[model samples]
Each structure stands twice: as C-alpha cells, then as structure tokens.
Target: MTVKENFELAKKAYEKWDIDIDHVFAQLKQVPISIHCWQGDDIGGFEVNQSELSGGIEVTGDYPGKATTPEELRQDIEKALSLIPGKHRINLHAIYAETDGIAVERDELEPKHFEKWVQWAKKNGLGLDFNPTLFSHEKASSGLTLSHPDKEIRQFWIDHCIASRKIGEYFGKELGTPCLTNIWIPDGYKDTPSDRLTPRRRLKESLDEIYTVKLDEKFNIDAVESKVFGIGSESYVVGSHEFYYGYALKNDKLCLLDTGHYHPTEMVSNKISSMLLYSEKLALHVSRPVRWDSDHVVTLDDELKELALEIVRNDALNRVIIGLDFFDASINRVAAWTIGTRNMIKALMLGMLMPNEHLKQLQEDGNFTERLALLEEFKTYPFGAIWDYYCETMGVPERENWLNDVKQYEKEVLSHRE
Candidate 1:
C-alpha cells in the first residue's frame, strides 16, 4: 500500500531469516560508490590541448548536451548525485584538471590545477578518487605506456603517475578520506609479440620506480588495474590480470579489477572471494561487458548480485572498494548514472536480504536442493518494496520517478549545452 507499510511487510519476510533490516540500512549507508566523472563527458576531459580518444577506449553515440567544461561536468554530476540514494565519491582522471586554458603536461600537473575540484568536493561533502590518465596522449600514441620499450616514454608515464598520486594525496588530506589513485595503462600489442617478457619486465621496473615516491597510506592508496586485451592489444596485453595480480601481492598494492576486462567466460564474481583471501584490500570497476570489453552500463543481473553476495557474505564490504565505470553516450548521461548506480545499491541490498548464514549452513550440510530452491525463490521476494523505502528514506525519488527528474533537468540544463 504505502512505502512504510510495504517496508514493514518486507521487513517481516527478511526477519524470518533473522536478518536485521535496520542493520542492512546502516551497512549500505556506509558504502560510498565512487561515481566516475568521465561518464558525464564521455571520457572527453577538459584539457586545453585535448588528444583523440585512443588506447582501446571508445565511447559511442553522439548524445546531445554532453558536458564540455569543468563547471558543466561537475554540475551534471551534482544532478546525478541528487537522484542517487547514498552519499558517494567522485572518481576523476588527471585530464580533467583545470589549468585556466594553459596547456599543462600530464607529468607536470600539480595540486593547484585541481584546486577548484577540491573546493567543490568540500562544498558537497564528497570524497574524491583519482586516476592517472595513461591513454589519449601523444606519449601513448604507440599504445604503450608503462610497458613501452623506450625508456624515455616509460619515464614520462611514471612521472605522470607520480604526479597523479600527489594530487590524490591532496584530495585525501583536504576531504579527510583516503583517495584511491588507480593506474591503468593501455600497453599491449595487437599481434602476437615476438618477445613479451621485455615489455612486462619494463613495466615492472617502471612500477617499481613510481611506487618509490610513497605518500601516507592514510591519504592516497595506490591501485593497478589490468586488462586482458584491448582494441589494439588483442594478442597480448602487457599489464594482464595475472601480471597485476602477482605485482599487487608483491608490491602490497591493490589490484583493481574491471568487470569488462576479463575473458568472455571469466566472471569477476568468481574471483572476488579468491582475491580477498590474498589481498587485504581490492578495488572494483563495476561495469557490464557484452561480447568483449564493451564497458556497458551495469544492470541488476545475476553476476552483479553474485558479486554483491560475495562482498556481503564474506563480510568484506569495507575491504572491497566499489566504484562505477561505464560511459554510454547513447542515452541521457544523467539517467545512465542514476540507473547504474541505483542498480548497484539495489544489488547490495538484495545481498543483505539473503539468508546467507542459512545458505552457507545448507551447503556445509550438503543440502544443495534447499540451497538452490531458496536462492531461486528469494529472487521473487518483496525486494522492490524495501528498495522503494530506501529511496524514500534517503530523500530521492522512488523508482522510475527519478527518470522524470532527469528529463526535467535535460530540458532546463542539459538541453541548453549545445
């Protein structure tokens, strides 16, 4: 009937399994999904001397009203955040820096370039995350960055990454939350490499150099994201999953896993528990992949739920850093963010509602039939009711009503961008 009444009924259903409905809300509130800023601009950063989008990253569709300026991008992000349920962080790339129309080399960027961003984050009470933009630059024209054979090119990227970490540290110190500075380079060969070891060895050396400039862990945390293959590097990617996995362990860095960066059949959900066993902390770029590394918007699918279940059941919610990663220029950009982020929170909510303890006991007792049955049955539970209540409680639009807000914003704000 009403949001509260429906929530009450749903609460009773979950209570049967001894699930603390209030506790679930408390846990979910603590999770701050880092919403990627690139999505608002389709990865087109605000550099005065902007380069073409390269390095196996592609954003399709010529959607109208794409954010073209720093103020515009931040404004659009604010709009999306209003519709989202919980407090969240903004994930930014180095190219998004503002230099007052002066061309600042990536290697030369400093905290001053992002002073406005820090101020905006402070105003909004949002934590900030950082990424070293390794692609879409002249240095990466050959599709190699950290793993490039040329020592000069490798050093350039290393310098840029070092600068990025310092910026991240700035964000952390100003915002009172540690910033995650992730490094993902598009270094690979399209054709089978005659010698793969040289590139990977160079990459290892370059990483060793970058990590030498260490900031306090309380401010900036470092992460390395690996991709199996990209557009130009279908044959072999230098920073592969196995390579980064081993490197993260040895270096004590976090391995950032992108859901779209795996083989066709490989599931990120399956790897979370295993990675958690070894890594004290890991990061996730939650995006959907279709045929290849498509970087599609995340949906409320089986894999998303399973991924959330792993985090919730293993009690590693705080350990796994969750962030959204996908840019679809085809749809309303603000709506895209709203839908994907809401689904992520929804998946986590569903995971909390599950009888995880009972399910684990069933498996331990060899009760596969009951486990399977309950799992299927819970899929049709009163999940929507609880979700509606959450949105209402969090002071956002309930369900599809958020779409109306997006449409109105498109009319009032985004439509005027052109």
Candidate 2:
C-alpha cells in the first residue's frame, strides 16, 4: 500500500483507543528540540587563545570536514537542520561567539560579540539557547572553575557566567522566546579531597553572586546542571545532583538533567516526575552514555522512549525544555545531527501515540495482566507509518532519503573545508 493508505489505516486503528492521531501530529510538530552547535566542530569553538579541550571533556576520532570557523559552523548547522523535520532551536556555547578576529576575554564578553549569531538565528527562524563555556580555559585547567580555591580564578568564572546570562537575554528579546542559559562547571578533584566542603561552599557563594542581577524571566531563564563525575573528576564532582537539585529549589532556578551525567544504572526517565514536583521548570540535555559520561550520539533506544513517555504521561511537555547534548567526530557531523534529532522526534511521536490514560486506568484498577499485554502489543503498532506521514507533512525526507542529501552536501560543501 501507499504511504497515505498505511497512515489512514493506522489512524483508524488508533481511533479505537480514543487517540486522535491528527492532534498528536500537531502537538509533536510544535515541540522544538534545541540542537547543540558543538557537534559541528566537536566542541572546539572559535575563541582566541582557546586551548585543547580539558576539564574531563574528550572528543574521540578525527573526522574530516570539521567546522573551523563561525561561518563554516553556521553553514553546517543550516544543512543539518534542513534534513531534520519540524522547527528547532540552536544551542550555543559562550566560546562560539563571533568576535570579528579580536580577542575578547571570557569575563569581558558582551552580547555584541554574538550579534551576528542573533541576526543569523533571526533570519533562519530559529530560537537560540546559551551555555557558559566553563572548561578548556587557563583558569579551568586545574579541574576547578566556580569552586576554585583561588578567589581571583573563581571570580573570573562568575563574571563570565553573569555575562552569558545577559547574552541569553539578548537572544530571547530579539527572537521573542525565552533563552535557556545553562551553567555546567567541571569542578572536582581527581583524587580524594579532604576539603570538599570548602569547594562546595565556594561554589554556592559563586552561584549566588552570578545570579545576583536577575534578568527578566520572559527573556531569559537560568538553569544549573549537575554531573555525577567526569574524566578527571572521578573522585568527587562538586556539582553533584544533590547540590544542584537543592540549589535550584532554593534559588527558584531550573535544574538541568543530563542523561549521561548520572550513574549507568540510573535512568533519567525515572527522575522526571520527582523533579517536576519541586521545579517550576526542568531542562534536559539528552545524550547517550555507553557506560560512563561519554557523549555518544543519541538513537531511538529504550531509554529515550521511556524519557519521552514520562513527559507525555505526566502532561509536562510545556514544563520540560529539551535539548541535544552529544558530540561524535567519528562520522559525518551533519549526519550525526540529523540522525540524533530525527530519532528524538520519532521517540516523541511514539510517546504521543500511546494510550497513556488507558494504561493508567488499567494500573489503577489493578488490571496488571491487561496493562502488561497492551504494553507488549504497542511494540508492534504501526508507529513507523505515522512517523512517515508526519515527516512527509513537515516537508522532510521520509526515511533514508535524508542520508543521500547529507552525502551530497558532504561532497559539495564539507569536502572543501580544508
């Protein structure tokens, strides 16, 4: 049968469960996932005097056609977004600012540095998000930033973060959407440290100072991220989940939950409901972690489906902010973005097609057998047909057709990057 015929059948089948396939498609299209800009350059931003990636971050492989300048990166981003379905946002790091060949110290950065990005985003009809680059800097080489023992070094990072908030506000104001400014510091010790309390106290004080001047929430929202541990911070990471969770609650800020920032056995899907109870809003950095905090490209894995289900089931789609956070330099950079983003959209569509209310009713009525059976039955549903229809309606390639476009772009554009 043709694609439309299959979709019609699937739509009728879903109607038996009182599910509106059209409504699901409309809702899914409106949910925007912020694609990270670092994937194009493997986290190497165009900053003067920028050193090699440090502070427990590492990007493996030597992929050719990696973006080297702001223009190249933006071009690559445009190509990737073309292949992915639906409207999306771009997530930028502080280091990605266009400074016009001049050196701008991190703490001295201003919104003018990113005026070009604002203009580009405006032209492309994309929203923008911001992150303070807290690693790979001279002051961060010691594996400490906001929690650094040296007062001068700590203050430098604090000022940088404050500046980042203002830049985020600028983007939001220009784009007419709130920009989520997330702060993630790679501050911890490689070995056991007897003075953990001191660093934690310093970090708390530093955060307080950085957030002293609150920007308008309509334009900017603050989010603090926590990591279980990183490469050099295996012993103790100062921004543990507990620390940021408490800080976010007390300070009225959003807490960002990075999937790869927790233990392997811990699924971020389980933490969603609990966090929503206390947080007015929650931010997500969705990535796949093989075993450790390795930022592997995302796929339509079980965890991803579960995460999407949690959001849809709890009716918290508006309360959660979604963003991609993976960097794989092994393959085509543009394809990596396309694959991860398309998979994310696919997962959300699957979640939306689920009969969540019916499942809840079964569980509440102690009908465990029917609930388990229906869950298994859903595995064989015609979700692919619905996904293809959505893609076709959104004016993107239905399936592997996008791969051909990425390959052609690599030959035409990315191949000449050197």
User: Each model's TM-score?
Assistant: 0.99, 0.99
lDDT tens per residue, model 1, 157-244: 9999999999999999999999999999999999999998999999999999999997999999999999999899999999999999
For all predictions, the C-alpha RMSD in Å is 0.7, 0.8
Off by over 4 Å in 2: none
Instruction: Look at candidate 1 and tell me the lDDT of residue 329.
Output: 98
**TM-score result, candidate 2:** 0.99
- lDDT score, residue 101, model 1? 88
Which model scores highest in lDDT? 1
lDDT of 2: 0.93
